[model samples]
Target: MTLVKSLYAGIATASFVLAALPAAAEDDVKIVASFSILGDMVEEVVGDLATVTTIVGPDADAHVYQPSVADARAVAQADIIFVNGLGFETWSDTLISESGTEATVHVATAGITPVKVDGMTDPHAWNSLSNGVIYVTNVAAAMKEAMPEHAGEITANADAYIAELEALDAETKSKLADLPANRRTVVTAHDAFGYLADAYGLTFLAPVGIATEAEPSAKDLAVLIDQLKAEGAAALFVENITSPALVQQISEETGIVIGGRLFSDALSERGGPATSYLTMFQHNLGTLLDALAHETAS
Candidate 1:
């Protein structure tokens, strides 16, 4: 289990990163997260009360994730497991089954209503800070279930985490309140920001929808380019998990400059700008405001 945790932390052959910040775990309960985002959430709510292990690490795409042997082993040893579960991790089911883990698998987005795209669940609920509160609530409940003795401590931690989320929610709305309707339209690499757009009054157009499993077809790219040309956009941004090549191509064809990187499905590395879920959203909000709001102000 130790080796498996190390593997997820990228002490071996993987580009993935550690779960969260500098905190020593009590190691009381073994927790497995399907990806870095959930890992960070688990850390925030449970603090050091639980030993959290992540399967998909920093800047890695969970939609197309391939679970490792180490991940399976970790899941097998876990006392609790957290997954986003809107068909987000296609590989999670197989991995959990093969591992024969008896750990209670918790879905962070279980209670929230999901955004649908073409009759498919968007699976990116964490994009909105409001929905993130739901995630933290679910995490806190699961932690209490796993370690009943630490219920008081877990509740306190979850309250702090939720407070932060609520603060950010207010900040987002305040910051974006002045943004005009015409300037609210933005372009991203994929359709992962629907919840965010809905929550904050923005419109996101993308070449790829929901997941990045398939490369955007030429027609899809053409359509996106044409839409941007016809209606215009505030800014075009690329996701951390996706390649900038497609975005670059769209920019060249449509004459819209690429804005900056957005942490869509994953968090950045430990020393990077967005190591935790809160920081990831903060970073993305800043990026958007810098390009859309700041530029408009200037």
Candidate 2:
């Protein structure tokens, strides 16, 4: 597997693939989103005008995701493929080529300047409400380009959706504003919150960096435990998509309470707390506020 270290590299590669697609049919719009989050965004814009399929399902990790034969078949039959560029879906190119998809592929992160984690650009743009708006706009633009007849409708829907995202951004700030500045520090399993931290005026500390696939050393854990104690980290939380064992151990050894389970890489399944993109943000904000509120009250 090629280790993609930068978002710009991923963008360059995606542009190359997108440049290769021939013009597609109008009514035969079939979209294959690389993961469920992008799938949700695409569905919001395209609605009934397109048939959508997601290669990675709800609560699944895209970092080390391998393409199944069925997923390859889905790509093979798609009319257009939408992906979150910036090395989010590393298996995408191989799957698309192997599946023999001649479809046009679009990057939903097209317009936004992606925030990088480590030396590479972090691909989890949907975590920030501001970035989420840009994602929706990119999806709408792609839909419009593919099916010009619905261009006006897609644009209108995107505008309405963006309005809601603007509200979400404001509401998130409002929800987080009550916590004291020192109490805003959060420790999670991975560096998934660069965007969230930048947006909400909170601080994120992870012993582990961009990938949860890696395990922190005993020394690293000890250092982190000390940092949590010295920094007076208000809460520690486990991510929905990562193992809770490390976080539980951190909580136990450090005596810092487990604040909450955060929905990080993937959204929850239908009927769950974070089924939709909006609901996911709401759930995360509520969980964080509850923990911090408890600390403040005491």
The 10-residue segment with the lowest total lDDT in model 1: 10-19
Each candidate structure's TM-score, on Cα atoms with residue i matched to residue i, is 0.89, 0.88
Please give me the total number of clashing residue pairs in predicted model 2: 0
- Residues 35-96, candidate 1: write the lDDT tens digits: 99989999998888878999999999998876675776688667899999999998888777
lDDT, model 1: 0.85
* Best of the candidates, lDDT: 1
Question: Per-model C-alpha lDDT, please?
Answer: 0.85, 0.82
As for candidate 1, its clashing pairs are: none
TM-score, candidate 1, is 0.89
lDDT per residue for candidate 2 within 1-298, as digits (tens), equals: 3433343344445555655877556577788999887888788887788899988889998887867656765776688899988888878887776555778988888877778776878888888999999899888877888889889889888888789889989999987888887788878999898889888889888878787677788899899888776666788889988988888887877778889899988889888898878888889999998887777311
